[model samples]
Target: MFGGQVAEVLVNEVPEDVYLLDVREDDEWRTGHAPGAVHIPLGTLGERADEVPRDRRVYVICRSGGRSGQATMALNQAGWDAVNVAGGMQAWEHAAREMTADGEGEPRVL
Candidate 1:
C-alpha cells in the first residue's frame, strides 16, 4: 500500500467490474488506456470529483504509479474508497491487459 494508508493493487488484481479512473494527460490517454476507464485527468479531478461515484470502490491509474497515488490519497481523504493501481499503465500493458486507443493506431502505452 502507498503511504501506509492508500490502498494499492497490481494490474492483475483489479476486478473486472471496478470503476477505473485514468488520470493521465490527453496525449498519454490518446496513446492507450484501459477499455472501460473514466478519463478525468488529475488536474481537473478536484472540480470533477462529483462525476466519480461515491458508492463503489474507485481504482485510479496513471502512466506510472506517481499520479495515481496522489489521486488515491486525495479521494480517500475526501471520503471516497479509492485504490491506486500500482505500477500503473506500464504494468497493465506488461501484463497484457486489454486497452483501447483514441485514434486509429494500435493501443499501446506511451
Candidate 2:
C-alpha cells in the first residue's frame, strides 16, 4: 500500500528481535531477495506457521504486495506479530539492493 526508498532504513531501524519472512515461491526466491529473509512459501504457511518465531515481530514479503498482504493477515489472525512489507520485493528491487540465491532455491542476505 506504500512505496519509497526505505528498505535500508526500515531494516536498520527495526529492533534486532524482528524477523523478515519471504512468502515467494522457490523459483522466484532463487533469483534474488532481501538480506536476512526467511523463505516460507505462502501456500504452505498454514502448516508451517509453527516454524515462524513467536519471540519477535515479522515483516512479510512476496513478489508484490498482494501475497505479502495476505500472508500478513493470516499471521495476524494466527496471533503472530506480522506486518506486510508494503511493496514487497518490487519495492526492494526499486530501491536498487542486491539479491542472491541459496542452495534450496531460496534467497539469502547478500
Candidate 3:
C-alpha cells in the first residue's frame, strides 16, 4: 500500500518514530515489499493483537486499501492505533515504484 511507501519515506525522512505493519498474506509478502516491515496477516491479527505495540505510531498496509481499511477500523474500535494505507500497493505501482513478487512465479488473480 502507499502507506508502506510513505512510512518508508518517513522512516528515512522523519526517522524518529514510525512503524510499518504489513497485513498482506504470506504469498503476497513473498513477492516484493518495503524493508523493515513486520509480517502479520490480517486473519491472524486478532489473535496476535498483543504482539503489536501500542507505544508508537503505526501504519497498516495490504494489497489494496479495502482490507487495510477494515483492519484500521477494527483496531480503532478495539482502542488500538491504526490507519489505512490509501490506494494500497496498486496505487504504489501507479507511482512507478518497485514491487516484489516470487521469483518462482506470479500470483494468479482469481
Candidate with top lDDT is 1
Estimate candidate 3's alpha-carbon lDDT, on a 0 to 1 scale. 0.64
Q: lDDT for each of the candidates? A: 0.94, 0.71, 0.64
* Candidate 2 residue lDDT tens string, 1-110: 43431222233233443588999898788778766788999999999999999878788878766788778877877788777776567776766555666555544422
Ranking by TM-score: 1, 2, 3
Q: List the residue pairs that clash in candidate 1.
A: none
RMSD values, in order shown: 1.1, 5.4, 5.9
| Tens-place lDDT digits, model 3, residues 10-49 | 1223232357677888877877555566779999999997
Looking at model 3, the pairs that clash are: 1-88, 31-100, 31-101, 32-100, 32-101
Write model 1 residue lDDT over 1-110, tens digit each, in one string.
Answer: 36677789989999997899999999999999999999999999999999999999999999998999999999999999999999999999999999999989999998
* lDDT (C-alpha) at residue 44 in model 1: 100
Candidate 1 stretches greater than 4 Å from native: none
Give the range where candidate 3 is weakest over 10 consecutive residues by summed lDDT: 5-14
The Cα error of candidate 2 at residue 37, in Å, is: 0.9
Please tell me which model should have the higher TM-score, number 1 or number 2: 1
lDDT-based ranking: 1, 2, 3
Q: What are the models' TM-scores?
A: 0.96, 0.76, 0.70
What is the alpha-carbon lDDT for the whole of candidate 1? Answer: 0.94
